[model samples]
Target: MPQLITAPGEAVVNRYRTSVVTPRVDAQVVKRHVQLGDHVDAGQALVTLSSVAMATAQGALLEADTELRRVKQLGRDVVSEKRFVTAQVAYQQARAQVGAYGMSDRQIDALIRQGDAARADGRFQLLAPQAGTVINDPFVIGQIVAPGYELLRITDESRIWVEARLPVNEAEWIMKDVAAIVTVGDTQLNGKVVQLHHQLDDTTRTRAVHIEVANPDHRLHPGQFVNVVIEGKAQQAQQGIVVPKAAVMRSKDGDWQVFVETAPGRFEAKEVALLRTAGERVMIDGIAPGTTVVARGAFFVQSEIAKGGFEIHNH
Candidate 1:
């Protein structure tokens, strides 16, 4: 059987998100390269920092390197054993400190040979951890930054989620492939129900559901306001002539007749045996085939079909 228009709704894309920047460091936050709305690839630099801490770390690294060389010179020499052990220990300790903060092994090796501080808390650059769209990066040039400060916030826009609230009065019939139009101002997106929430809202007495919509087209933005309309189903089985409830008249004698639209504005009164009525549609037996029964805005049409005026419930 042909399907009636099922559930339909309006929805949009959204994501769980937050902004981040490093805590204030001794280094000057030289600049923020990633800006709001910019798409950043994984490991791409977003902020640069120049700091005394970096310089100090570098210097310590160099000192360790020098000590390592002196220790190596006495390698396998038991007589200079204590001096060799001290130098080796110093180098190993310094190397560990720098490595703890993501320093590369190659950089550490170079510092071992060089007497200069292996690392200097100099200008530093921070890279993006994942590919995402920058959302809240308002850092200006020359802003000082630290390890725990927030530099910027980027949202992974590839996948987005939407939270829709439904009143308990609206039942589970409101779920599934409902046609939904998600709107962000003038922009609109179409999506279907991915899931409905199980928990109920205490204050609003509503349930919140989550929807997933493909945004590979990048039309939908995260955290945008959206409106959803859930169109529910209507069904009356046992196919026969379908008529509007209004046109199926109940007489004082308890009989039913419907106005069959034989012409554009003309109709013929036809007696019908009622099978069932569901929602606004009714199934009636013995109705002529190809009969155009009135369905909508049928109050006036029914009145015209009535040979004599009859009482109808006003309320």
Candidate 2:
């Protein structure tokens, strides 16, 4: 059976799928299009803001558009080459300025359609850059937010990351893309090893292993604790007896041992070393081949021996 390394892990948001919504210009929140925990699609409007800087840029863009149009109608033969070039550059700069203020190209086209300067209200909407659920929305209407101020956070919860810390020695057998099983309470999730940290933790001296798990139903959440069993290559393969896990039990002295039937209806306890486990079966050492040992109902035999006041020790 293949080796399984179990460790405690934590579920965290996949940074690559998370998006932070912020404004490029200082603005006052005008209204919110989506609330916290709402699922939003890419290009969906999230919030509207009003900025004085946006108004100035929009007004300039309108002026530059009019100048460019007039220069085009006049023709290169009529207008000076320098004048035509200046108008074209000014229009492009104006468009870029508004775009930098978080206005989409569609919105800029709409603004141009309005044509009148009075209609340029400096109000624009911030849209979701990707499809995800709104995990956080900290700003309220009428709140003033500066450039790069995080107003909302969106994350695709369909997939997430699990960070598992493994002992340095055991980590050697682990490799990227290995299969892993993550248990959260009664639920089990399948995952794959995505990364392995080279540096060991300062205190634990364990390497960090990152596993990517599919969370289609969003059952796994960030900061949730889980048990991870990673499939790894065996350090060294050796011959051993494979038996049901129930065959082994802890003795009175807390050592792992199995009940061996010495003769007819006679049983004795013998210590054994556990090697590795796969599913319900385990490989163990310290026992000879063809040795008749209890493969099932080991606990019952242990209890029966205790009731008879017999000390469970090796011969």
Candidate 3:
């Protein structure tokens, strides 16, 4: 797995998730199969609408199509161009208008040719887009539903996550394969942290952290108490020269440089390349292990030199 480069975080479980306010075509309900507290699977039909208008539109398209075909089939010289166009326009307009009622293009065309459209009960078929438990109060038979009315509400409490707020600075280092131990009530399970938001809120100074945990046995609900640990190491172990963090300093020009102690009461300013840093120590190149390095108070020497505290070596 690739390193996610993660930071500290907390875990949470969201108990109730609602997907509501979808498009409903029909105004009146004819059949209702689901009720409150019902477990529904994906694609389960919850309700059906009475499609009176749907069937009517099919008939209209069929009539228009028959007229169009009859007029066009007659000797081309017998019908004037304008009359032909008028019939054509009428048929096309009827076909388009009926489609707004939710008939497929093929069905509308077929109905025009055969004078019979595939039966649209003018009723709506409500299907569960996801698997979850129904939070009823949907609709009773004879209830009128508008275009954007919410007929049903389902809560998929089984698959849920706690949306946790994390600090921006720490969230920036999140690794995709970050592992954390999640605490759910008295239970502890291993989980993975993912989808760290690169942007942070200016006012709250928080970033969104998505922690995904599996609840196969249905042990976890949508909203629950949990904690997250974001562990990270800033340094990589390898063969290299190591220097105390204090030995590295900025010059007047803001460049990184370290002083090498060539001998007792003797020092020389030498430049070194920094690799990575551990706690209080930095790994650098160019300086050997036995080479006397000014491990401490290098800044004081810089200050001393700035104040003319020591003699300059003859170049």
Instruction: Arrange candidates, best lDDT first.
Output: 2, 3, 1
* Residue-by-residue lDDT tens digits, candidate 3, 132-219: 7776455678887777777777767654564556676556566665665566657766666656667777888898777666766666
Q: How much lDDT does each candidate structure score?
A: 0.62, 0.90, 0.64
RMSD of each: 8.4, 3.9, 14.2
Flag the better candidate by TM-score, 1 or 3. Answer: 1
The local lDDT score (0 to 100) that residue 275 gets in candidate 3 is: 75
> Which has the better lDDT: candidate 2, or candidate 3?
2
lDDT of 1 by residue, 1-315 (tens): 112222223333344533354634455767778778898887787877777766666677677676677567657654377777777787777777665543446555665445444345454466676677887765677776556666777767665666677766554556566555555557656666666778887897777766666667776665566655444433412456776677787644777877666656666567779876543566788787787765654557566546564333331
Model 2, 1-315: lDDT tens digits are: 677788899998888899999999999999999998899999999999999999999999999999999999999999999999999999999999999999999999999988989967899999999998888899989999999999999999898999999998889989999999999998999999999999999998999999999999999988899999898875644458988999999988988899887876678999999987765678988889889998877887888788874444443
- In the predicted model 2, the residue pairs found to clash are none
**Which has the better TM-score: candidate 1, or candidate 2?**
2
TM-score of 2: 0.88
The backbone clash count of each candidate, in order, is 36, 0, 22
Better of 1 and 2 by lDDT: 2
Deviation from native of the Cα of residue 170 in model 3, angstroms:
1.9
